[model samples]
Target chain A: MDKLTPPVSGSRYSVIRAIIITWMTLVILGAFLLDIPRMNILEHTARNLYFHVPMWFTMMSMVLVSGIYSARHLASGSRITDIRARESARVAAVFGVMGLITGILWAKFTWYSGTSVWWNSDPRQSMAAIQLLIYGAYFFLRTTIDDNEKRGRIAAVYNLIAAATVPFLLYVLPRQMESLHPGADGNPAFSEITAPIMRAVFYPAVIGFIAIAWLLYRQRVRVAILKENLTSD
Target chain B: MRLHSGRTSWLRATVSVFLKDTRIEWRSRFGINLLVLFVLSSVFILVFALGQDTVERNVIAALYWIVIIFAATSSLGRSFISEEEGGTVLLLQTHVPGSAVFAGKLLFNLVLILIANVLASLAFTVFINATIANWPIFVVIVVLGSSGLAGATTILAAIIARTGNGGSLLPVLLLPILMPLLLSVVHAMIAALEPGSSWNDVGNDIATLVAYAGTVVTASVLLFDFVWKD
Candidate 1:
């Protein structure tokens, strides 16, 4: 593997950018154009499976990238690595908020239709709220400190912890509780229930979203590194 | 003067810090007094808020944990900030290992949280007329949940103490980290308070709380060095 292929610090590739944009455009088209069988519950809105689910996967990947940088920052005591961690977390937070907003819209129409409620408080929803707050706390923590090095080190500790708690908050605790979303004790995931024709779009949607998410993180890291350089000088 | 061995001295230093913290707190009575006031006020507010209506076991359980969590958040953060204020942080840092300091503070936090939780729960039982059928499980939940709370508060206090705005950052950072533990404990408490509940009914939640406390305490010990040394 080339050294430039790494997620932390990578050279820009116009080729990859074009591919991701094209792929995501296709996904957007497929999301609306694909023929999904009408369901008793979701009806046409079940098409949201392609968009809403991948948001979380993309956010999780961003968090993983953040944790990797956090661990690297701790081990190496490098400010640049810490910058990567912080930027990655910021990008992850953007995706997480997007995931949440999209979730609310999807649930609003499908689950809580005709009700005035926007926040239905599903188990997954509850845990995601907690997860987001935990990340939000990281940025709050950063604001309370003044020194750049100290802020990075301290926030890196918090970032690591926030990442560590993700599985527990997002998966373990919610899985144990009764919930409307899939992966509960009795209810299998929508993936299992999805039609064969839908799989084509679904797979591409997930891949395309994840690919674009990676690009966003990479760009964010580039800017962050540039900021760090400008500030240090 | 004769010197003690290294291991014994470290243990002695830890115990002494724990006792010294207790002694200072005994004299000031700040945390305990504030905790009592907070707990009593919250319980009174709840009583007035709920009125004479019969509440479900779930609400009672939820309210109980909410009060304990609030009390822990308000009080437990002072452990490290006091040292910071007194300018003894540097003195203590030069003398003890981070693990020893963390252990000492954690011990004090656990005891303090336990005392506050008991006092608050007793107030709840009296004022709110809340009763639990399974006493032992309720006590277990109290112990385990507060242990996790204390663990989180202890570490968070160390982090917050270093910051300029220690007061507000405590809850913002501490509460979310404590959410998983709090969720399980509240769930278990609801089960334990229900009439038909046995240890069997709440076994999973109890296990989760225990694991939470263990994990947080261990993580604190490892992370304390980073937070405290600076």
Candidate 2:
């Protein structure tokens, strides 16, 4: 019998983890402290731009990672690939939930400032909620299969289908509708509306969040691999 | 048995499976009966609940699609469940390719939903008094929406049929995948219901529906082997 090696080494993993933690800490600090010209509707809640948008970026990245791994698992039939695919999807769902919550809060304070409206059926928000349901269904499908290999293959097929649908849900369909979100329905995009100074922090915030998501996903994968090794041996 | 004999074999496999399903369904009439009763009773309940007040087209369109989608989600899971239950899946696995089975099942679901939606729309017109202003666009939407729903649900039906508890999970797995199609169809249906809507109004939506159906069907064919073989 052959033994599987870790994809990333111990020292390299530690170094990456250290960088992600420090980078995320800096992004959070900058999110609050970085000063920009205040606007009427946004006010200080504009700071949410740093937190809310990046969750989506991280979620998209995680979903991309998960889908790629699922494809690889289909091609190679490797247990490790299946583990990575499932773990990354789990992380993607976490970020998707965070993105949805942050988005609701941001919209409530800004778009629905005067009223008691929490949800406006905003297209983007609906899309995010639907995305979360897709992820929930994925996990539920996994639980239904008792055989380990059958679960992996079936779940991988469903994951690919779900991933294929994301673009239509998030980008294609939303753009066709009237969304309060930026860059939809012929509105100016974030780049046009945002100040140049904020871009410095926003871009880094996105990258940092994605890196942190990777770190979380890697930790889970490592733990899963350890458990498999211990049980198999 | 010659699964890889090229386009002719593929088409023959697809047609045979489709014919077999249609023949089985024609004899038993189980799927159609269930779907028709479900659609009729639900619309009856909706009409009774609404109390004869003239509903807005927007509300009518929404309700109409809700019924259609629920009808699909509830019944379409049987596409593969019957095969599993009857213990014929092994025979089919030995004879036809997975892609052909997918194609045939997709065609069956497509025809089934077409009948269901046609009956549903008829019921809508009979009870709800909603007039479709644009016939061409309405027909296009009905066809495209059915294909999209059929394409998306066929593969999912295969997946859930493997699990012992399929009835509860089909909608959970389906609604999200079908969201884009539903949204587009509802929007288009609304436009078609309006007094003077044009194809120009729903051009983008029709395109989206087409793309959604195409993507789902293609992805399903490519990935069906993994689910079907093991």
Candidate 3:
């Protein structure tokens, strides 16, 4: 709860960073090393359940964090809140792109093996791509304005507007259409299908990925604040 | 004048703004002309590009909505930019509440988009021989989808009006936000075109369209003050 103005170094921060790094390393090792129940097409690629799925969970968390910061920025008109919002969204966009690239690779070898189709227009995949576009638009809107305060206010407004549409775009519309992903069209969701052994790694992967996103966001916020301080002084 | 007035006056101000915009547009015919020309050109291009091949209902539905969306994007950004260009933004800001201004512009844009959509669909029918199997659901989708598009874009137009390249930024900002509504409407249109499809078939799409419109419009009203008062 200490002031994050100079969040560059602290014992607690270093401790948490150490833990996260060690934790993610274990998750990645377990992802490949663990023996998972195999299915016909999913096969060994089923281990992707640890890496690929967590990217989305982490991205979604970043979205929620960015949106909360955007709302707080609007309420308080504070540069700190604006910085948090922008940085969190930056992390969110990074995770979103990573999620997309991993999804394509995973889908290529498993679902479309031996075919030239990397993009099959799955509803969930398409929605993720659109979500990334929304983030792009948010960043693009920021660039169009010159005044820092004006940019913060207007970009905050736009970030909130775009976030408001995410639920419908990512969840509602995609559920209506058939998709290759699970949890669609009465297919068993992850919980129903995943063995309990896999859940051990899966849950921690989600946490580890989200924690990484948080660290990235914090780093960006600190850097931006320092830059602003240097420029204004 | 009280900045925060009773509901009656707020409604009156909203209507007055709508009427003023309507009167100006009536005289200038800019919005209508741009929309009509865009719709006609896109439909002509589709006809030429599509040729005599019988296209699937899904593709036709997609084309129909795509044309309408592009026409809207091309024309709707001008609503607030025109006010800025004429230097009436200050005059209007001094006179009306931001919420009322947004509502009025939303109403005007809704009407404009509705007209454009109807015109585009009619062109689809005439040029490509498209036919609607279910009139009731198709009309509902059109009304709800147009309102959703208008509601979402009106505030964006206001936001971009102050920026340097408002014209180019509108679609980039708009299309991503409009994707869900567009997909739902296109889905509903495809259902409506299927020979045996009924309201039951398009129920989710209708609900999505209505929800999309409600969410965007409500969010815009609450947020327009931030965008407008600056």
Candidate 4:
């Protein structure tokens, strides 16, 4: 089987192409419209809402998918399901690294001064780092086991159990602790800002990031299937 | 097909697994003894490094937690490695339900950590000249914190046991997952050590620790069957 293929001329491809074009148009238009004076302070930082938040959103979405696949693999003992879960986890890890980098850039612009530390032990930062570390081990654990079935089951269980800690670390623990990060107890909600026009841009940014993530996920699944078929043949 | 029927049979199977594990662990005390020694030596090193001048109550309390957290990681890493090595995991899998196997292993690790905690606490008190102002609260924190440690470590150890080079991989996998528990325990210990710390001061930390333990234990139990099926 060929590894790559172009889409045939059809309604499905047209619809997909149209959706991508529309998304791109809206993102550009929103950026142009929101660059006006009143919403300009949010310009650079607002750009991050599209990039950074979406990286996190996508990472979380992929991790959730990975966890579900892992559960299914464990319940049914299927190597195919395990392979899908593994691929989802690999993509999640990529998104996680991107999220961290984007978050650091955002933090530098928003929270840091010159000569400040690159990282902080803020509960949110710590917890996010921990979540990354836990999933990092997920891959390590998978590689160490020689038996495919055993490795899948073990990794699946770890994924499901470890996923529980993600919420605690990401949300609960951070909220309980004192931190300089936004969304703390006394901080104003980002969505509650007075700029109506910025919201128009922000919502599209969220959708655009999610769309990009879905595209990446689909590409990964395609690649995995191609590899499976190649090896089987 | 069916492993066993009836609640009593399940309970008996769990106990049998537990006893078998304990007996096996007893025969080869190398891993647990090594863990205890590691804990003791680390406490000594911390005491020396921190020095008499730095021996304030808070610092000592922090050191106490640091020692226990690392010690628990080292101990729990070995909890299942030997079983996997001897093909005993397969044997256990054949005999007991996955849930029972996890329960037996979890209980064994809990008992191991409990001993480690008591011994470490005693060493810490002597070496750091620290005294627990609230004995009950101190014990409560140790139990809750160690239980959380055991729960997280048991699942992780099981996951890494069959992996190549899992010896070092265990701590890499464990520390991040146990951070919340570590933080809560440290806070609780500080409150317990403070002369003026009231129950109100330590209450939140204690509650958080208990919640973590409960959540991890319940999650491990529900998910262990899925993990062990392989």
Candidate 5:
């Protein structure tokens, strides 16, 4: 394989801008077209699929990135790699919270009492809450340590260990517990017909969210580097 | 002075560390007393919250497990804090292998939890009239369940000791990881406690608890080197 050249950093903004615009257009168009189907569940609640599923997709994607970066840092002992890992975790947390909020809203509208509270022992809800708690502990662990090197190493190790548990908690354990969530047998959320339509907008939504989160991550890293530089000088 | 070498020396080191920790704890009286008091208070509070109504045995069994779990949290949190606060952990780290250190601490914790479990079980029996038809199975569940708890908590407490908000953050980090262990223990305990309930009823749960404990112990042993290095 030929060695790849890095893109010119400043010129990359045009690509990002195009991606953003394309995502917004597709989202607007998808919402407009979803009405043609007239499937009862897909009529009103289907709109949420575009937003909610993508949030979860992005969150999982970012978490995988975090784990990859963490493993890289552990193997290489690179500070930049550790920073990237930490930033991925932070971005994943943001998307995770969004996924959870959207899910609860969808639950209220679709499954819960139309007029009253709708909290039940649903496995999906329970496991989602547990996932949030696990990552919340991740951030808590990061902040509570004082030494930067120790913090990075500890958090990276923890990220990897905790990531291993997520699959079991989110998928395996819930199935064992017999959740009320649809698609336990096989989640129709990702069925062939729906999935194709989902991918039409979802792929871009994913790219868009990652780009947005990357931009934020870069900004935060720059600020942090500046603070360190100023303090040293 | 150079520490002793060889497998016999390692065993001796393990025993010494275990006895030293137990002796220090006995002298301090803080950990054991606090654990005992916390266990008693939690049982009383749970009993009061649940009330004396003849609720379904399953619900009672569930509630019983929750109380035991929360009580375990208190003792588990204390297991490492005392070492850290007194600087014993730093000294211990210098003298023992990571696996041996984990082993000694785990043994100490398992014994402490066993004592607490007995007291809590008695309190549960008196409060809920909980009847265990199979004493042997009941004992086995308690032993396996608490061993699982001790293994998981030892690793978590080690992690938490390095954190600033060690007290509060410990439970947040621990409880989620402990869920499967907690569920298995509760299921096994319910099977052992409920009238006419058989060991076969919780066979899967017991097997799971055994697997969880073995997996956690192995993982912690493998990971402790990385964890302790920093």
Candidate 6:
């Protein structure tokens, strides 16, 4: 009973891949091409709603995937489940980094312009960075444990505990303090539905990015399985 | 019948573990000694650096919490690390329920934190000449705040034991877990020590600290067995 063999052989997902490619192309086209209402200081970068925000949505989806796989890994003690958990976290981290960079770029030109401040210490920004650090510690923990199975179970428990922190960090902690970000706990949030035009591109952009992240996660898991099987043999 | 004794021994084992841990501390004063020294020196440093009565009440509260947190980081990982380093972890695992072991360690950490903070608070009052406008409110915040810190770190310490890396990794993992607890408690402490501050003013921050403490302890109970055994 080799653990790395596909639990079900030949799980092909090429068709879904094609659909994501097509949807993402359309979302990208709409994001830049669509005319958004002009606002003071925010001018045109508000279209970042389609790009920057979706990066988080996709990152969060991968985190949820990572958490589920971690839970299953503990229950079944399967290396494949462990690999899935690990790879998804790695990919989600990439997206999280991208989101942070893009958020900084967006803020620099708009909110912090003339002030030379890349980071204004906003609660939302600080907490999101901390959330990423929590996951970073998860990956770091994996490297410190040498035993394969022990690493899996321990990292899995840490993953569950880390996932428990996301809500408080991303949503709960930020809301507790005042911030420039819209829809903070203190402010009335901008309901995406009110602006039908931006919402049109925003929803698809979210779906498309999440779909792309799923593809990347699947590819990494496949490679991990082959490596694990080869080493065991 | 065996099940009944199993339950009884579980409670008894936890108390024994708690006793053994305190005795070990009493004998060696390993982490606790370091903590007490850390507390006093930091307070003395504060007095020397900031002139007498020149500091604001809120600043004093903040400084006290910072000292306590650093002191906690120095010692709170000892409960699990002591067992792991002594090679008694597996021995304990065989007899005591994981929950019982965690309960014992958590009890030890809680008492340790309470004593250390009270001593630190006293040092702050005497040496730093810190003022406390609301003693009862400040006490409530300190008790809840310390319990939360202790509970969160105990599980993390168990997790940290599995890693090959030495003690360096504990603080990295601990900071994020302690953020919300730290933020709310600092605010509550600030409010409690400020002149003319009332219960209504500090109520929300205190509530946040209580809620954070409650959730973290529940999480420790649920997650400790897996971390302890695996």
Where is model 1 chain B poorest over a 10-residue stretch in terms of lDDT? B1-10
Ten residues in a row with the worst lDDT in model 4 chain B? B1-10
Instruction: State which docking tier applies to candidate 6.
Output: medium
**In CAPRI terms, where does candidate 4 land?**
medium
Instruction: Give the runs in model 4 whose Cα sits over 4 Å from its true position.
Output: A1-14, A25-29, A36-46, A170-172, B1-8, B56-59
Select the stronger candidate by DockQ from 3 and 6.
3
For residues A1-233, could you state the per-residue lDDT of candidate 2 as single tens digits?
24557666579888888888898898888888888878878888888888889999888788888899999999998888999999999998999999888888888888887889887777777877887898899899999998778888899999999877767776455644568777877777988878887888899999998888888888898888877777775
Clashing pairs in 6: none
* DockQ of every candidate: 0.58, 0.71, 0.72, 0.61, 0.47, 0.55
For candidate 5, write residues A38-111 as lDDT tens digits: 45444567667677766777777778888898888878776667777877777778887887888878778766
Give the Å error, residue B228, model 3. Answer: 0.3
Candidate 2 has a TM-score of: 0.94
Question: Comparing 5 and 6 by lDDT, which wins?
Answer: 6
**The best candidate in terms of TM-score:** 3
Candidate 1 wrong stretches, greater than 4 Å: A1-12, A170-172, B1-8
lDDT for residue A69 in candidate 4, whole number 0-100:
95
lDDT of 6 by residue, B1-230 (tens): 02233556777877887888888888998777888888888888888899765778668877888888878877886667778889988778877788988888889998989988889888987887777778988899999999888888888888888778756788888887778777778878887778788888778777777777787878778877767885
lDDT of 5 by residue, B1-230 (tens): 24554544766776777887788888888778877788778777877877877666667667766766666677667666767788777677777787887788888888888888788788877876777677888898889988887887787777877777666676788787777777667667767776677777877777777877787777677666666665
- Model 5 CA deviation exceeding 4 Å by range: A1-8, A113-115, A170-172, A175-182, A185-189, A192-199, A202-233, B1-9, B134-137
**Deviation from native of the Cα of residue B172 in model 1, angstroms:** 0.7
Give the higher-lDDT candidate: 2 or 3.
3
Ranking by TM-score: 3, 2, 1, 6, 4, 5
Clash numbers, per candidate: 0, 0, 0, 2, 0, 0
Question: Which sections of candidate 3 miss by over 4 Å?
Answer: A1-4, B1-8
Per-residue lDDT of model 3, residues B1-230, tens digit only: 33334444788889888999999999999889999999999999999999999989999999999998899889999989999999888877877878989999999999999999789878988999899888888899999999999998898999899687878899999999998898899999998888889888888888889989999999989888888887
Per-residue alpha-carbon lDDT of model 4 for B1-230, expressed as tens digits? Answer: 22453444767777777787788778988658877898889988887787776467667777787777777777778767878777777777777777887777888888888888888878887876788888888888998888888889888777666677766887777877777777778877888888877888878778788888899989998877665654
What is the fnat of model 6 with respect to the true interface contacts? 0.47
